[model samples]
Target: MMTFSPQLEQKFAKMLTAYPEGKKRSAVVPMLIYAQDEVGSITPELIDEVARRCEVTPLQVDEVVGYYSMLHRKPMGKFHVQVCTNISCLLVGGMELYEHACKKLGISHKQVTADGQISLEEVECMGACSWAPAVEINYDFHHHVTPEKLDQLIDGLRKAQ
Candidate 1:
């Protein structure tokens, strides 16, 4: 069985109304976003719930969740750190910066720290090649990062919180 808050049900209902009859599948993406926002990550149960509410199949919800990188399939830290390791970033010292972050945080790529404050992931082309060796913390991008600056950046986030 799946549980949903009244708010989520209402939001899902509104989203379903936006599509024509029998086209409720169109709301999968937004429903995934809403689910992720509520639960911090998308789970099989959540997908099933969304499917039920939207009158679609669970596989349909799964497809939308799998297609979007922004949709986290597993639990992530409060701050998701995505480092660019594409051609442009690699040409510049992205690898070194990534290594430094791993060393400092004591976690490898695609892993979250034990404290659950941060999760590190390597992504392709953050589209800031000109500012190579970049990382995105949540929604903010930090460019031209060096080993020393990485420490400062992490510390700054901690202090801000």
Candidate 2:
């Protein structure tokens, strides 16, 4: 009942090659990322399966998932909007941007919209210091975002979806 396939096993094997010998533990994160990509969402069962495939404990796998906000443990909405609220972004009104997105969607940070189309989150950073107060929607980077732009983006995404 591991819910794994040969294709998944092959992917795990290939990703494991990126790490050094007898250091499969170092490959845990990548493997979990692969698992997450394959399933879209990480379940307790999926974590356990990744742990078995990577020869690590379930706790170890779960720990990695919990440590990273980029890693999704539960199912997210159609769009996952992660706003950077760290120091660099904060100085550029990242906090206000997050608040605006929440108010616009009527869902607080980390909460999915009622229609399951949007999920808002406050992340540490998005590595676009030049474009501080940025947001990543469905992994697409939107830099130097303003409240008006946020509304436009949400509207466009809703229409597209």
Candidate 3:
């Protein structure tokens, strides 16, 4: 049987009421976000609960979650670092930058560091060709990045925490 904690139930109830009855599907995205936020990653159980509460099929929730890169199906570090490796960035040494990040963080793409502080991901153009070799940490973009600059940024983030 699907079960949700009182808090989750309340939140889901509120989410349901936020939309009209027939448009409960509109809550899919927000529900996924809430589940991810609550559990740090979306699980099958959470998806099932979301589907049950939102009155949608599990496949519908799965489709939406899978379509978005921001929704992590598995565990990820507190900070997610996505490096752009598209055509423009590749021309300007994006590959080298990605390598440098892996070496510095001591983890491969789609892997989280041992310290659990950061996870690395490779993505297509971040729509910043003018500033090729850019990386997004969480949501902020660091553009026109060099190895040295990236090192500094990483250090700054570590220091900030």
- Compute each candidate's TM-score over C-alphas: 0.81, 0.84, 0.79
**In terms of TM-score, which candidate is stronger, 1 or 2?**
2
lDDT of all the models against the reference?
0.84, 0.83, 0.85
Best by TM-score: 2
Which 10-residue window of candidate 1 scores lowest in summed lDDT? 1-10
Cα deviation of 120, candidate 3, in Å: 0.3
Task: Report the Cα RMSD per candidate.
Answer: 2.8, 2.4, 3.4
* Per-residue lDDT of candidate 3, residues 22-89 (tens digit): 88888888888867866778899888877877789999999888888778888787788888888999
Q: What are the per-residue Cα lDDT tens digits for candidate 1 across 1-161?
A: 66668998788778889989889878888888877867879988888888887788888788788788888888888888888888999999998888888888888887988878898988889789998889999779998988888899888867765
CA displacement after TM-score superposition, residue 129 of candidate 2 (Å): 1.5
Best by lDDT: 3
Q: What TM-score number comes out for model 3?
A: 0.79
- In model 3, the Cα lDDT at residue 68 comes to 86
Winner by lDDT between candidate 2 and candidate 1? 1
Candidate 1 stretches greater than 4 Å from native: 1-21
lDDT of 3 at 17: 86
Better structure of 1 and 3 per lDDT:
3
Q: On a 0 to 1 TM-score scale, where does candidate 1 land against the true structure? A: 0.81
